[model samples]
Target chain A: EIVEAIAGALGEGPLKGRRILVTSGPTHEPIDPVRYIANRSSGAQGTAIGAALAALGAEVIFVTGPADVPPPEGVQVVRVESAREMEAAVQAALPVDAGVFAAAVADWRVAQASDRKLKKTREGLPVFELAENPDILAGVSQMGEGRPGLVVGFAAETDDVIPHATAKRARKGCDWIVANDVSPATGIMGGTENAVVLITGEGAESWPRMGKADVARALAARIAAELETS
Target chain B: EIVEAIAGALGEGPLKGRRILVTSGPTHEPIDPVRYIANRSSGAQGTAIGAALAALGAEVIFVTGPADVPPPEGVQVVRVESAREMEAAVQAALPVDAGVFAAAVADWRVAQASDRKLKKTREGLPVFELAENPDILAGVSQMGEGRPGLVVGFAAETDDVIPHATAKRARKGCDWIVANDVSPATGIMGGTENAVVLITGEGAESWPRMGKADVARALAARIAAELETS
Candidate 1:
């Protein structure tokens, strides 16, 4: 009781009783022991969100892929490797007030990963088969038993950020789409900073670029406020 | 020539000829020598965007306020403290292909900051005077000379994310707006992950929550793809 009082005194924690599920980082699609397909994601954003949510007093379940960054404190973290693993983890953590799909899951994965590292042959580079991964956000949004009240997805595009994001939202059937231009020049991959657009079925809102931590805090606060009304 | 060959061998850089401008972090409004008004911002999203843009081969100029995280590599980074300083820095680095306003500029600043640390007596608390700060994103978007081709803004809201974001886009006179809930309970303020909605004059797109780095990469890639066609 004393601890709770101290916490309440420190900040006006709005999320006193809420469950939030978040995912982060990149999933590696392995071709062999030495080679894999993956994106440059540091998981900084997801970890920060988890921390921010905890600070606001919500019970957080953070599902993450292999990331170079550490997970935030005060949150229950479930670590996974592949998209399949992440999806399962998310499903297990569901029936929450809100769900945020933050991981950079690979669109395609190797059909079969060799147990041993493959070496270059005299003929040429080896060919490998690929398969599409399940859209975790879509699956969660459409879940029959444990669907979250709010489901959000990420639309990382190279061109036509808004248009593509809009299309993705419809196709994926998610409630919100956070769009960004991820040209290599932006240095967003594997970096700490970010700039983004938040789009919903109703319209769009843009924010000035700022630190991920600040963004997370602002987002957490907004979620708490909305949850209160909803 | 050899160096060029090696670089080409690595990959076909998409943003080689492009220019990008990104703003990041929270602006501090000073109250006294020992106090200032600021928000919770780490500048992760903005820095990640700047890095992502640079990775795609665009020359990126990053203007940021104080941040807890480090800026991305291979980009020109200009650090500032207050909103006024951030605005000046952004203005000096204009005429880019794209502009992303991700900084959380203080809506108000101390009208008069005491030169020395405020001394407290046996009396009550001290009162502060505040004034509005310049809207850097709107300023750059409306700049007559050396204006960026595309202007993006971010709207952080605790309620009516879509409506507020849409209004912000129109009021700010920017091409796009990213809206997200930033209520304290969501853990979005100081966290690493983000979930946002993209708002534009046409419509809105919802996205899943993801790492800030992935969001940055996606945004950068989309920007590159657009530039390629445009």
Candidate 2:
């Protein structure tokens, strides 16, 4: 009874009953048995977000592609390789309070992923017939009933970040869009620091450059506050 | 002088005065400022090989892509992202006694990689014009007078391992081809264990399943012996 009183005073750190889903890393679209098409996402920011959310007492389900960094310790990690697998994993981890789609999902995959190694030939360049990958963010955001209350998607752009992110937020039907420039000059693609703009229905707010962990903590706090109000 | 004599007695592991170059990981070919094409190579085997050669007193120049595993200690690490960068790095590390091409270099790159982010829309699928990438292994093997004394390449095959590897060895003009089956059933791709077949001018010799480190040690020993005789 005394412990319960202290717990009540602590107030569960704001998100004790919340369940969050986060997708991280670069999805590999198979070209052949041994070859794949991927992106340059390291999953650093997403993993940090998962950690931050867990720290706030949210039960986080992390659906991750093959990432350079290991998944956060506290989150339930669902490892996947390709965009299709990641989509499946994300769908399976649904019915959460919030969803953060941070994964750099490949836009396309080989129409028929080769079952064997593709041999180099003297003929000419090989033409890869590609098929579009499913838009997981849109799917989750537009869910009829199981949609998360808060849906966040990422737009990694190099030019006109704000405008593009705003458009992406509307197109993906997500509640918020975190946009960041990953130009070579910015060194944000695989770097530790991030400079991002948070876009919502209200407006756009740009944050100064900070460590990935800091951005993640801020985002987690914002989510907590929003959930509290809702 | 006495310590030098003792070292001589211990044989210096046969690669004492040799310089070796190794390539590892999956090269990322950019599609846009933020998107790229890559593979699933973790560079575990290549890193282990670098470590093994270093342990044998060989000067190892380790050229790598954005790999999951950190480069091994006691070696010169050259970090790169795309196949072109990797090829340039390999060329810069020339005049080595041996060259090991183990990287899963992207076979093609976007003909004109966009300078900005590519927008997604309701219009249609975006078409990417891809150009063939330089065959690093074949180029190094057929380097004529500037080529290393011993050149090795890798053939990650799923079916018909021996025939395909032998053909690859002949086609690439490499002295040896280390072939492995990366079929999903094998659980070798990105896994800690490996089962490889060494194809030389003599014949093919398949090794049993073992840890990647053990495979590296065995390969290093074979390289040492070949260098010693040559």
Candidate 3:
């Protein structure tokens, strides 16, 4: 393991010269001074993927939201909270060999997010007007001049996983989509194990249920192989 | 410290035979299976307060949300997620001598929280219809019978701290209100040190800035004195 680590550090792996951008964790959209909207993505899978890619000697720029687990070792980590911040951070690390959109960014943000705490009035509950957040993956994937070689997006669905993921892959204009069922019964949102369907241009490929680290390794290997061919 | 621990275990302190309840952390109100609303309360202050109460020989019931800090030792712990769940757990641990409502419970929850994740469509953003959560503090404070000897409430305000907390205490019919400024600039929302204003029947008493543990010890001692006299 130590020798492998040294080899990775010395740029000896297949992906030695490749630069990869990985966005991980759940973005928190501020509602008020004290409260915010958040997702249950713990960034476990994304963190593992970053580690795996780094192990393969990729120059990894990890733009992450507020994740439960700490960022992995031997990677450049950029922390962000809101989806807007994550988008900005990702844009800054642009023109990479591959872009992995793993962070579960909030689809919308409170349009009138209060600077001060909102007081409960005698009338009724406060109304939240939401504005759509920017689609970071689509923005980068459709970039004509400075697009990455490969753009991978993640789909965390609760129903009709394969169809939903396949549709997402088409809509996002990404090379591949790693989709997983995050239903409460599945225990995969924050759990270590992952059962994912990898959707590509050819078709949807279902991978066996395995640990997040193993899934990351398999995905990283696939990415490396694809990059090697192209 | 060893002697204190032994003495507390033996119920040899001022709060011997007294049962106290402490609610700590921020309640998560789910928007969907994967999305939720959260605050910055780490439960550091409440954890310290529970420990201090336990050390003083009180039978402490620690009701906690998903806090960054774990519950203190020597207390019966109850874990919960949403405000409604926290309210239920707190109700189950009632009829105590004193109740410290320290948890940053959400005042409102999405009325139409869906089991399935809401998807974006041509219709645009989803409207979040909110319903007011049960006011646990007020429910306990204004109880005609079986009311605790003392019901203390906490106010985390971004502006007009004293006035806001004072109004909150009066509205909730609580005996005391511990108010603190949680503005981002203060760095007190999730930080270790706290500068609080204690409001009683008389008036507000501002305490000098101090560590959360010290603040907890002071508050716990005050509660002990109040319970002793009552």
Interface RMSD of each: 27.2, 1.7, 0.8
Stretches of candidate 2 exceeding 4 Å from the true structure: A1-11, B1-11
Clashing pairs in model 3?
none
Candidate 1 on B1-31: residue-level lDDT in tens? Answer: 2342233234337878777888888776665
Better of 1 and 2 by DockQ: 2
Clashing pairs in 2: A38-B38
Off by over 4 Å in 3: A1-3, B1-3
Best by TM-score: 3
TM-score of 3: 0.98
Task: Quote the positional error of residue B162 for candidate 2 in Å.
Answer: 1.3
Given the true complex, what DockQ would model 3 score? 0.88
Shift of residue A101 alpha carbon in model 2, Å: 2.0
Question: If ranked by lDDT, best first, what sequence of candidates would result?
Answer: 3, 2, 1
Candidates' chain B TM-scores in the order shown: 0.91, 0.94, 0.97
- Per-residue lDDT of model 3, residues A1-230, tens digit only: 46655767887787899999999999999999988999888999999999888988999999999998999899999999999999999999998999999999999999989999988888999999999999999999899998999999999999999999999888889999999999999999889899999999999999999999999989998999999999
Residue A10 lDDT, candidate 3, scale 0-100: 83
Regions of model 1 farther than 4 Å from truth: A1-230, B1-12
Model 2: per-residue Cα lDDT over B1-230, one tens digit each: 24532443343656787899999998888888767777768899999888788777788899999887899877899999889999999999999999999888888888999887776656866778889898899999998788999999998888999999999899889999999999889999989999999999999999999999999989998998999889
Docking class of 1: incorrect
